[model samples]
Target: MKDTVVEVKSLDQEWARLILEAKKIGLTKEEIRAFLVSTKEL
Candidate 1:
C-alpha cells in the first residue's frame, strides 16, 4: 500500500562484480528483493 516503506538501513546493494568497484559486499539478489514485499502499518 501507499503506507508501505523500506528503511534505508535495511537496503544495501553491491554491483562490483558487474560494474565499477572490485570490492564485493552487501545484500544478494534475493535479499535485495525483500524490500519490494507488501507491508501493513504497525
Candidate 2:
C-alpha cells in the first residue's frame, strides 16, 4: 500500500505522546496492530 501523509488537526500530538508512553512500557508492534484491528474507531 502506498503510504502518504495527510494533514490533520491537533490530535496528532496526543497520539504521538500516547505512543511514546506505550513504548516506554514495552507495548509490542504486533500487540498494537492487533488492538487496532480489533478497534472499530481506529
Candidate 3:
C-alpha cells in the first residue's frame, strides 16, 4: 500500500468552545457525534 499523509486543521474556535461547554455539562464525544448525525435528517 502506498503511504499517505493527511493534515488536519484545528477545529473552529466556536466549535471548540461549544465542545468545551458540552463537556463541562457532561456530554461525551460519542454523544456529541451522535447528536450531530441525528441532525443530518433535518
Candidate 4:
C-alpha cells in the first residue's frame, strides 16, 4: 500500500546514506557486497 511504498523509499535513502559513508571511509563495493552476503547466512 501507500505506507509500504513510503517505508521502502525511506529505507532506500538510509541505505544510500550508509553506502556513501562507507565509501567515504574507503570501503569498496565488493567488500560491502561480501559483508552483506555473509550476514545473510547468519
Clashing pairs for model 1 are: none
Whose TM-score is higher: candidate 3's or candidate 4's? 4
Q: Model 2 over residues 1-42: C-alpha lDDT tens digits?
A: 999776675567776777777778999978766766777675
Which pairs clash in the backbone of model 2?
none
Q: Which ten residues in a row have the lowest lDDT in candidate 4?
A: 1-10
Candidates sorted by lDDT, best first: 4, 3, 2, 1
CA lDDT for candidate 4:
0.83
Model 1 residue 6 lDDT? 69
> Please, what is the TM-score per model?
0.25, 0.54, 0.54, 0.67
Report the Cα lDDT for candidate 3: 0.77
Put down candidate 4 lDDT per residue, 1-42, tens digits, no spaces: 354335878888997898888889999999878876887899
Taking the tens digit of each residue's C-alpha lDDT, what string does model 1 give over 1-42?
478786654444433233223224565665444533422222
lDDT of 3 by residue, 15-35 (tens): 677778988999999998887
Candidate 3: worst 10 consecutive residues by lDDT? 5-14
After superposition, the stretches of candidate 4 with alpha carbons farther than 4 Å from their true spots are 1-6
Give candidate 4's root-mean-square deviation (CA, Å). 4.0
